[model samples]
Target: MKVYNTNQIKNFTLLGNTGSGKTTLAEAMLFEGKVIERRGEVENKNTVSDYSDIERENGSSVYATVLYAEINDKKLNFIDPSGSDDFINGVAAALSVTDIGVLVINAQNGIEVGTEIHSRYLEKAKKGAVIVVNQLDHEKASFDKVIEDATERLGKNVTIIQYPLNEGTSFDSFIDVLLMKKYCYAGGKLEISEVPADQKDRAEELRAELIEKAAENDEGLMEIFFDKGSLTEDEMRRGITVGLIQRGIIPVVCVSAKKNYGVGRMMEFFTRVFPSPNDVPPPVDTVSGNPVKCDAASPASAFIFKSAIEQHLGEVNYFKVMSGEITEGMDVVNNKTGNKDRISQLFAVAGKNRTKVPKLTAGDIGQTVKLKSARTGQTLAAPGNNVVFAKIDFPEPKFRTAIKAVNESDEEKLNEALQRLYMEDPTICVEYSKELKQTIISGQGEYHLNIVKWHLDNIFKIAAEYITPKIPYRETITRIAQADYRHKKQSGGAGQFGEVHMVIEPYAEGMPDPAMYKINGKEFKISVRDKEEYDMPWGGKLVYYNSIVGGSIDARFMPAILKGIMEKMEEGPLTGSYARDIRVTVYDGKMHPVDSNEISFRLAGRNAFREAFKNAGPKIMEPIYNVEVWVPADRMGDVMSDLQTRRAVVQGMSSEKGFEKITARVPLAEMNRYSTALSSITGGRAMYSMKFAEYAQVPGDIQTKLIEVFAAEEKDE
Candidate 1:
């Protein structure tokens, strides 16, 4: 690999809906650049970008692949990202690093879901964009329809830079309107010729439009065009580059990548018209809390934004150099954790292939192997620089499942694999629930988790079985009551004697306030209230209290009394979900200096908490999620009706998918396996996103059923 000055580099990301010919277009560009002997076909699973086994089997890209082509003394870095919606994160990461984005659309399909989503991201990125109408060689392809859709959906700045000379089967040539020449492919070889006499008039008309659009970006060219009504070739070229960088006009090119038609001209357009790195301003940290100007000449500072675990190479972290340079064997500091690390081996990646590089300059993307603590979103910098880069906020997980090793004996391997996957993909979350006794894994969707487990089994050689995860449930008190317990055991040698008196009260609804359970040696007084107001208890010195009475309870045994209450908090008063946000006070108690040991007091406190919870009115709490579902307009009725049945509250609706985006709040319990249900209702065409909303009181009837179910399960366990 060679290092090119930033001014000589042009970066682009290829994005569109599945089957939109992104991979094929990349192959065609490579073929035209003479980088590859022949253009590889996607159907044969030989395309450079879609190189993974899963991608080959599924016939779609699941990761971003990096490759470059040199044309006209300029280096063009092409990032071919996945088009499937399930792997959208890869597309986003690719876009974040590119200087410009070329949105490819299949002429047969027009604007699609992916087109809309990625267009929005590019708009937010504020990068120059071009729309490529591909697959002109297909019998069903319609350039006019695609152009209309692109103009209407994308914007009016889109201008045709080239047009196909023939339609469908006859599409073997193109007219470059900017250059006023014709390039035709004959027997897979490119031939340049004068514009045909038959289409000369039409070609001139489009050429005039292209020239006029370009002139608008340059004052000198604009004056020439206005005064003389004509642009010289030199003036046109200069204006085109300026227009492209300013995005005042976007050049459109026609191509049939499958047949390699017009690929050479496309490469010419990219090298001549696209803005290079130096032409565009560099990235600045926008993390709000701390911002750093990217410095290419300073000590290395890079942020790890992507990670992967290969079969033989333990871990690979993809980072963007924001300042200075990164080289092998240099010690780096993780700003996120303040931990020092050594850069082992740095390499530039092309999908699964690794090409070792001597050093990576600022604005370049490269990977380092085996940094023990570095994870996605972590920023690595030179030893004295304390800059933390802006973090990428990932989407919330939509699907969750409990995973267990199939053999049970491989539990340790399962844990290691899960941890490795978590480091590789921050979007994938893993956890262990002591109550449910299950190891749960969560991801963006079922497809996301399925692919993760697939990689674990095949690549990491760790096989595990996954089941739908359980909903997290909690229990609390609903009313006030008092209870007492005595622990007295007479043994041949010694006796355990401890007494606890306490009052339990219900925590108010819709508030995360703490409850107060007061215990005197003889009786316990508790006050439970909602967390809306700050009504801290006074005159009682305990966990968070102030005044302690004249030794009502001996200080020696106070620890035991509190321990009993703490144990009961873990065992819910109602349905056995851990109780939370409570204050316990030991107002008074008796202690025999000889027999009142910590163990006796601990057992006594535990018994008191259980008795207090039973006396208090206990109830169950349920989890809720904020949901947004995007479905076609025709499916609005079905989605609304389905949400109603699930007892969801519709918050708002917006436009999406040439359809409606419904925002609602629904119970997590109802959405345990909602991905399947939603897919079924929308015929697998709708998409949804969800995140934790807040905990709500379980409905009375449902709460009863939950209690019964939990009680039975507890007994069985």
Candidate 2:
């Protein structure tokens, strides 16, 4: 393979909805570039991109596959990510390295929910993109409907670069407005000629619009277009590149990747006009806060975008050269990990096939293995350079479930496999929740986790089952209460005698200290000598006051009392959930110097606090998430009704792009399987994201049920 410089490289990622022909389009592009002798079909499970056994079984991609093709003197690197939203992490990983996005849209479906989602991601990433209308050979393909939907959802920036002259089942030709020519595909070979007389008027009209739109990118081109009302081919290329880089234009092209029609022209546009790595903004060196430009003369820096474990290969890491040139047999240091690694070999990847390359220049993407330690989002740079690229901002998991091995002995092996899966796909998050006491695995949706389960059940040969995860509810007081307790135990040793009187109250910020607390018509005065406040790790505050007058209880025992109180706080008296935001005052206590040790005081304080919490109107608080859901306008009512059943409090509703955006606050317990429910409600045409908003008190009936359940469990244990 030949080494290409940054300017000679065009890095792009294919984006679309599932069944939008993205993998097929990649196969066609690979064929056109001569990288593959024959194109592979996804249904046949012979495509180079979806070569994984799991992918083959599912007939879909689950991870980002790195592939490359050469366009004359220019090298085109393509990262084909899965089109399903469940595997959106693939898209994010691809976007992190690629300079532009080639969004393949299925003409039969027009703008789909996945299309809208991927487009949103592209825009949020601030990357330029081109729209490819694929599957024109389908009998139901409607190019006009696609164009209309793209204009509406994609904004007015949709520029028609190519339009199918004969769409639908007979699709074989298209008019290129940019070139003012007609292209026809015969026997999978492209033939270009001047626009025919019958189509000349239509071609000229579209070309005029293209020229005017392209001219808007540059002041000089705009002036030329105004003066001569035209733009030369060379001038238009420069204008389109600028417009694309600035995201001021979304050039739309037509193709039938299945039939190999117009695929070559798409490749031509990629090589001729797609923004090179050097054209877009540079990635920042997080360590030095400097933009790492694509400069071969600078220090070497390669940002690892994805990682995987192959059948034979122990571990493979794919990266894009952010700066300088990296060659085989080069030593690099991961500043993030502080681990020195050697690039033992370099390979230009074409799916499962990898060709040895001498070196990869800046902006090129390649893979290397045998590193001692490294992970995705870490940068491998020349020693002393300390270049660390920022990690991709992946969205939090929307679906979560508790996973456990059927055989308890296989838990360790299951955990190890899960860690490997997490490394392969960061979106698949795995953790053993200390509070829930279960291994929680979260991802995009049910399907995403099912794929993970498939890996464990097949590849790892481990049996695991997913259980409903326990909600991390919290407990807090709703009223003030006071209690007193005396721990008197006469064992074989010294007698243990400790008495504690504590007044507990609901904590509020900026509230006056309790000079006196009146409860049940009884007033108790406290002379606070010292006080301390703590920010509890479980999500609230703990205020402790030393109100012992005249050293009634020694100061050394304060810690013991607080520790005991914290034990009760951790295991709330009502429902065993972590308790928060309560102030406890040790107004008065009695202790025997010889008998009252830390244990005695701790017992007394624990019992006294537990009693007070029970009388303080203790309530359960469930985590409420601020969820934002995007659904098709027609299905808004259906989605809304489903949310209502989940006890969601609809906050507001609005319109975003061409979808309805509904925001609500819902209890995490009620949202356990919301992703699956929403997908069913909207016929898989909707998506939503959730984040922790606040912990709110549960309804009285629910709280009562939770207490009863906790008591029953406690009794059983």
Please name the candidate that would achieve the greatest lDDT relative to the true structure: 2
Instruction: Give a tens-digit lDDT track for model 2, residues 326-368.
Output: 9999999987889888999999999998999999999999999
Runs off by more than 4 Å, candidate 1: 192-251, 285-296, 311-314, 317-319, 326-349, 352-360, 366-387, 490-493, 506-551, 555-559, 581-601
Question: What's each prediction's TM-score?
Answer: 0.85, 0.99
| Residue 1 alpha-carbon offset, candidate 1, angstroms | 4.6
lDDT, candidate 1, 550-641, per-residue tens: 55346666656665666666667566676654444333345565676777778877887687677666677777899988887888899899
Which prediction has the highest TM-score against the true structure? 2
Model 1, CA-based lDDT = 0.74
lDDT of 1 at 73: 76
- What shift in Å separates residue 29 of candidate 2 from its native position after superposition? 0.8
